[model samples]
Target: MYDQATIGARLRMLRKWRKLSLVELADLAGMSKSYLSMAERGERALDRRSYIAALADALQVSETELVGGPHLTKDPVQAAPHATIPQIRTALIANTLTAPLADQARPLPELLADMDRLDHSKYKFREAGRLLPAIIDELHVHAADPADEAEHRLALECLIEAFQMATFTTKDLGYGDLAHIAAMRAGEAAAILGDPINRGKADSLRIHTMPATTWRVRLTAAEQAVERLQPHVKDDTGVHVLGMLTLAASMAATVAADASRARHWLDHAAELAGRTADAPGDNWGAFSTTNVNVWRISLAVEQGEGGGVLELARNVEERRLAERRGRHTAFLTDVGRGLARDPRARERAVEWLHRAENVAPHKFRNDAKARETVGVLLQQVRSTTAGRVLRGMAARMGLPH
Candidate 1:
């Protein structure tokens, strides 16, 4: 029943009741002026859990109380004609964003439920992306506190995952800039919680945002993050090491872009994954040997090594088919693009690209290199209907026009 207009009205009421200007509220809440303005106007939505908590804290009320009903019902405190922090937070978290509360015993179930809800919801990717920054800001407010550190950390991780989903699900979304900012913020928050796994995840995202042409910048960020995390790497028997190894391998892959370098990194990553597997623990973030293989396949495709790509692609396909969750849409996109460039494999490459698109269009939409590969295939099938469809898709995705 909660609508954007109602949410905006409540936010304004709360600010006025507290006698705080928008600038003051934004400063106290650690958000930008523009975001605050949009929230007050109900032009923006909140999506991050931490942000909701922070808004609740700033308004000095429980999130449940703010959204469900105002406190002190006996006297029937007049519904303050203003926005309460908690109300704003609740409205945003419940309506705009998709981050779930970290249920200590039911985190995965909670996340799955939320994901289902998102799938069924009316919100589209463009709207969701627009709401992310404010959600991140709200999450920041809660994450800054030393108390409730574990809950705060989990919320941050959830936010990071949500951001990833937003970035990966929307075609031609133009969210790379926002993704970088959110990843950096998440990294800072993860660092505060002393959770190396989250920290490494954030680092990986940060590296991903770097342009491939700017290898030096990416290398420096990766190396620095790894060095900073050196102390945490001693214990390699948990999900933490898997994240670290993935971050390292991803960075090394960016550096050399060669099969040998990639193989070395994957070997190390596999070793760490194996050690973690030997320990009695459920894998966090789905870290496993198969993940290492995916990374290896991606690298081989990147390096343009035909035999390696074919072998690795076959392995990935077989494993992914066996494990429904391990499907690497990004890796398949790479393979398709690679084959699309070669005359012999052009048909096969188009098939791969088609499959990749079906799986996740957003991931491959903005990739210029992939578009170039598809372009080659287009030339071979100039008069075919498939070529026209491919060309149209490429244009829409901002690939070579």
Candidate 2:
């Protein structure tokens, strides 16, 4: 099948050309009208080849016409010195830095705070990558023989957090293998030096890594993750882990196209979010009421409820969400996708995509759908200042320029 992002634009364009109502096309394709409508928009990725064949047949078009087109860049970017996962792989595999870590001399707490700077920054991986190996090395060496019990605990915590950050960064860029390695390392570290709470948090983080796995597999894993975390929800730490696990499960359910199952997880998450309002969050994300609402918008985007997404987006204060850079980047990406299907709001779609790129360069560049959205827009939006800017943005993103 063609990339879903390009499929939407082509479908929208061809449907208009054929003067076919969505109802007519959905009936012809034997799909629900809402699903056909979502496919015409960019929110629901048409992952199955069957959908492509059915739609092409109904439209009286060749499958290739619907599936293979120039508006999409089908291949991943070749290895660049600054390529996404390679740089991270290099960071994890080797440290080009000749000098050993002076971090060895730095207090673990101080070094951790420094690393936090990198974790929070958007796609600033090279700087973080350069620093991570040294930090990891120093932490590993220190943890091998702690001065005392308290020191051993701190050292273990540092390693767990480090591995957790590594897992998240790698996974977000679509590198599942590396993410699982890091996540497993985190779990291993936690298992050796953690209480029940720490183990639950580690489980939640590892479970969150499964999104890049197949949808069915990830959904199954999500169910297991929630069941495991459920019994631990008796304390503040338990509350945070439960919130994260439910969020992960809800997200997986959404991708699995099980709306009721997704809502069941979301309701569980909402309850956890309400309880965790006063609880602190670590790298997984803040799970407050507002955060739950933000995730609700995300789920709506996954379901291709563009109108509802926009409505929910309006209700949440952007600045507060924006402060959480990762989720803000996601929110903007979803906003851009939802808006691209609205002819009246198509201009704003470009604007929102640009905003998302600005917030997290890697999110747009590494994501095929985001790149396709820009590519399709570049093909469509000509003869305007906004169009020119979008063209520049797409070119910089390494679209077929």
Candidate 3:
């Protein structure tokens, strides 16, 4: 019985359940038979978006089914975020601009202030999930019935911010349906608000929230978004938003295996990042030199370029990323996952993952890639400390150790 709870295990089970030979599945997924065998045996990591998407398509399953998401933890603290998804979904689906679910609404400024606080939390998924539903309900009330045009604009801005946060919260917890709805809500609000930068922000969120299975379509949309935002890139916020969109395009390119296009998009983003300050904690997307490097490391990992990842990490401004919990943890997590593929670097991988967990345990524990990396490293455990750390992470994630 394959009960290891890893993607490779799931792949093997699904393949056998469908009565397909290893070579058959590989042929369906457009991969070599030997590569598919290695992936099924857990000798290779299925960490790339393209591979997972391809396998899921071949298996006639959703990507989430293959990835085994909406993970639940035995720890009450870690499971708290998952509990909030239901309310968020209800709030998003059941409420309309003219009709809100909540009875009383708070002032616009107060709600906006709350949104700002949540933004500065730096991807504390639990906190955002816990507080966003009520704020979203209230913000919709204000947007539905405002005093004046100025008040309505403020309400739309806050609503867009809240929707973006909701998208992040739900997306991380594997609630893809709610995430898509939240992103659409943001884009609608941005259109009404008629702010080009906010529209660009909403567009970037849409790109990120788009399903990886549609990499070709997403790549085209990202390219169009970058062009749309080009003339509006007259300020730092515009630059940040545009840079994020460019990065999104690069990610899609990477998933599609268009290395040349991905590098071109990344280089353009790097140039844009240089024009702005490294504001990792900004309400806008954290588009800075450090953030660019973080994306570079993650993209390199997706492409299975372990050596290139570290070389790219050399340019990450550690001091700037110190208190930016989201970007900091992301950088560490990708680096750890990137290095986990190398037998000699297993211990270093554990150390990097541990640092990331310390910075943001909630975010780190919920990360699907981080969980897969831990599972893969656990299978090859050697060093006592590394094994211990991997086991601890597995326990926290409610996975068998």
Query: Who wins the TM-score comparison?
Result: 3
Q: Each model's C-alpha lDDT?
A: 0.49, 0.65, 0.83
- The estimated TM-scores of all candidates read 0.56, 0.73, 0.95
Candidate 2 local lDDT, 211-324, one digit each (tens): 332455667776886787677668665777777778887877786678899999899888877775532224245676677777887777667664446787876666665546
Clashing pairs in 2: none
Cα misplacement distance, residue 80 of candidate 3 (Å) = 1.6
Model 3 poorest 10 in a row by lDDT: 1-10
Each model's total of backbone clashes: 14, 0, 0
- Please give, for residues 1-401, the per-residue lDDT of candidate 3 as tens digits: 11347788899989998899988998999988898787777766788799998998888888887887686677665677888888899888877777878777988878878877777765556678788889989988888888998988888888877887788888877778789899998898898878788898889888888776889889999999999989978988888889999999999999998999999999999999889887776626778887888898989898887644677878887778755776788899999888888877878888888988888787788777787888777778777878898899889877788
Q: Which residue runs does candidate 3 get wrong by more than 4 Å?
A: 1-4
The worst-scoring run of ten residues by lDDT in candidate 2 lies at: 72-81
In what order do the candidates fall by lDDT, top score first?
3, 2, 1
Q: What lDDT, from 0 to 1, does candidate 3 have?
A: 0.83
